[model samples]
Target: MSDSNRTDFTNPSTFILLGIPGLEEDHLWISLPFCIMYATAVLGNFTILFIVKMEESLQEPMYYFLCMLSVTDLVLCTSILPKMLSIFWFNSREIDFLACFTQMYFVHSFSKIESGILVAMAFDRYVAICHPLRHSTILTNPLVAKIGLAVVLRGVILTPPTILLARQWPYCQTNIIPHTYCEHMAVVKLACADTHISNYYGLFSLCFVTGPDVFFIAVSYTQILRVIFSLPTKDAQLKAFGTCGSHFCAILAFYIPGLFSLLTYRFGQNVALYFHVLLANVYLLVAPTLNPIIYGLRTRQIRNRVLHLFTHKET
Candidate 1:
């Protein structure tokens, strides 16, 4: 009997990725928005990088963190979108077992790094606003570099265990993953072996890796708001709000969809499977596409520099 027909444990060499379950027929059309989002993510992030690189006045801990954010957005989206587009456009669905695992790791790891970057950015804002005089001294270039390295290293070190634990399972069940990409839990569910550990570990990684980030961001913003409200002048208060507003929106863009996706998957079993899959893609894609617009286009310094470049080129 073939592996699919056999009852004993087996590891399939390849898995079939069902692009969007019930929405398979709509994939060609669906790719349109996804394609646009990916393109925007690429163009917008590069634009931020360009502005930060070309404008010396834009060099600060915040912009440096923005650079890290742009790069993470690029990698995070690139990790899955290209393959997802393949599935959408060309109906290419077969992924090697190893490739599937690789994709799962990249998707999870870079996302963790992105969350870390958001935390770092929040801390930057907190320091800048709450301790203005000490902002430069506290977040010096060396410290910024270390912060970047720490976030990057955390993602790299922490994400592999998800893949490792899942890989140990024998694929004695169907290798067909009814999702757009090789999501970690989706892959784990394919294992015929008991997956309580894998499932528990998934929750553990989410809590351990992302729980602190969310908490830090919450605390940072709480202090930031307290400082903002205490400003003597209304103008100063509004100005502070203006500066942090965009950052806050970017935070919402990252976390809200993400939290919804996680909750829906773990609890909302009655939710349509396609909804869950689309929400998964949203957390990964929407933030990347929106961050550049939120920060690069909205922030005064970066916006002014972007305008400077455009005006100079036009002249």
Candidate 2:
């Protein structure tokens, strides 16, 4: 093959993920907190899944959506953290190209699924609040199945193309990923090819997928707010807000850090690298860790079921 052709075709066999910069001495210290967070996330999400499955009375759409969210959180955290923990604990940052791409796919796909589930949960709330009489009819077993299928399909279809495009690029340049995990853009930027298309497509996908979900969620909540205020009693409004408060916290936990990280990556070039990386890690880690806590505390049924189960076990 010609030199030019070989140069174009050559890609690195592996990439290195540079875990939290300037904290090499503190990797053990940093990992202590991360390990705690990961364990909490796994346990919390598992507890949600177990409770949802065991408690027959919790077989409604809201809990079903919670189950989906928990499963997605479990998968998302597992995809990134094991490798990251290894990096932190053992300094094992070398990841094969295929493995890196695989991680990238899961991270992005599960995120999309999470976004879809949040929107679905919002819709569940909307129906329950706005059309209480028809909620069961509207969000039936079949419809829930369809929504789950669509969420998975959306991720499966939309995410692979980005990975495929990324794979085609030659990685003749350095393959050191700055972030702790295999983030899509971080990996794409390492390619020696023109990255404009990949970057633009990512932004486009973000807008096309998450934008609509956020918009619909906003619309759903707006209508929900309208309904809550229109109620005759102040106590009724308070009760209604209490029901949604967990989901609201989950949404904020997931999106705010995410948007901040993206904004910093694009616009805040003056921001410190460690701060950007920290925000990126926070975006992935905090939601999963806090989701179960949020739901456990704010969700009356989940809390009751969890306490009952533990109390029964103790007795």
Candidate 3:
């Protein structure tokens, strides 16, 4: 494992992924749960997308955000699940360096986009519940479209530099990436060259992407809570809080694990690797898997519309 004997990146046919090694022997057993989760996530998000698209009555700013979230989840799951399944099923762990970088880029980029989308969704709930009169004018379709564009722009800008920084590092000892996928720090740790720039850029990225987004989400919820408490009637207060229930659950599920993973990694905790893998899969699988269920179960309008649509199609 020295620089002198390392294979050149250009000539290598495939690179090995040093995934969780103990699971390698039990690939089939590991794959069973992964496949189930992946399928559930994909199908769930797809159903939401279809329901949103096919139902005219469900068209609104809130539903627009939900649709955007579904699409984001679909893309996120598709990006990571396939490679993971291939590794588990076919024992095909080798990946091209460029391909690995590409995977890392998309994984991080879509994750950023999903975070932005969740914030936007929370804001939509805030407006609808806290400022009902202004909600219609403020969150109109054109405004929602603009928000979507901004989310995409945010994701794209954050991704390129990270990928470029990654590509600059020359591999010395090994190309094997631990813990399933091409995580930024894991891959960079294998490089012989200084990763100071990469580490700096990663810190800046964490702040830029998660900082503002999570801040806005908190602000939105705070305003929402204030409005809820000011309501004269218990029913009104309950209704206001209920409006944000789904978004709130989704935010906690998505952000808590992610923030914990970053914190553990930055502080050099022993549990960092364990939490990283656990949370990485959470982003790709858990959030998306639960999103459709949460939305459909929490929102009566969406559920009713879906039922009606299905009834009409069948008739």
Best by lDDT: 1
- How accurate locally is residue 240 in candidate 3, as Cα lDDT from 0 to 100? 64
Residue-pair clashes per candidate? 0, 0, 0
What order do candidates take by lDDT, descending?
A: 1, 2, 3
Model 2 over residues 1-315: C-alpha lDDT tens digits?
466544333677888999987777788888888889999999999999998899899998888888988999999889988998999989999999899999999988888899999899899999999999998899999899899999989988899888988888888847788889888877887788788888788888878998898899999999998998898999999999877766787898898888777667657889888778878888888899998888654688999998888899999
Q: Which stretches of candidate 2 lie over 4 Å from their true place?
A: 1-9
lDDT: worst 10-residue window of model 1 = 1-10
Identify the runs in model 3 with alpha carbons over 4 angstroms from their true place.
Answer: 1-13, 272-275, 309-315
Model 1 stretches with alpha carbons more than 4 Å out: 1-9
Taking the tens digit of each residue's C-alpha lDDT, what string does model 3 give over 28-133? 7867877887788887778777877888878998888888888888888888778888887787888877888888898889889999999998888788887889
At residue 112, what lDDT does model 2 achieve? Answer: 89
The candidate that achieves the highest TM-score relative to the unseen native structure = 1
| Each prediction's RMSD to truth | 1.9, 3.3, 2.5
Cα lDDT tens digits, model 1, 1-315, are 475575454888889999998998899999999999999999999999988998898898899999999999999899889889999988899999999999999888898899999999999989988999999999999999999999999999988888999999999758899888899888887788888888787788778878889999999999999999999999999988987887898899898888777767678889999988998999999999999998788888888888888999999
Task: Choose 1 or 2, whichever is better by lDDT.
Answer: 1
Go through the candidates in order and give each one's C-alpha lDDT: 0.90, 0.86, 0.80
Ranking by TM-score: 1, 2, 3
Pairs of residues at least 3 apart in sequence or in different chains that clash in candidate 2:
none
Distance (Å) between predicted and true CA of 118, model 3?
Answer: 1.0
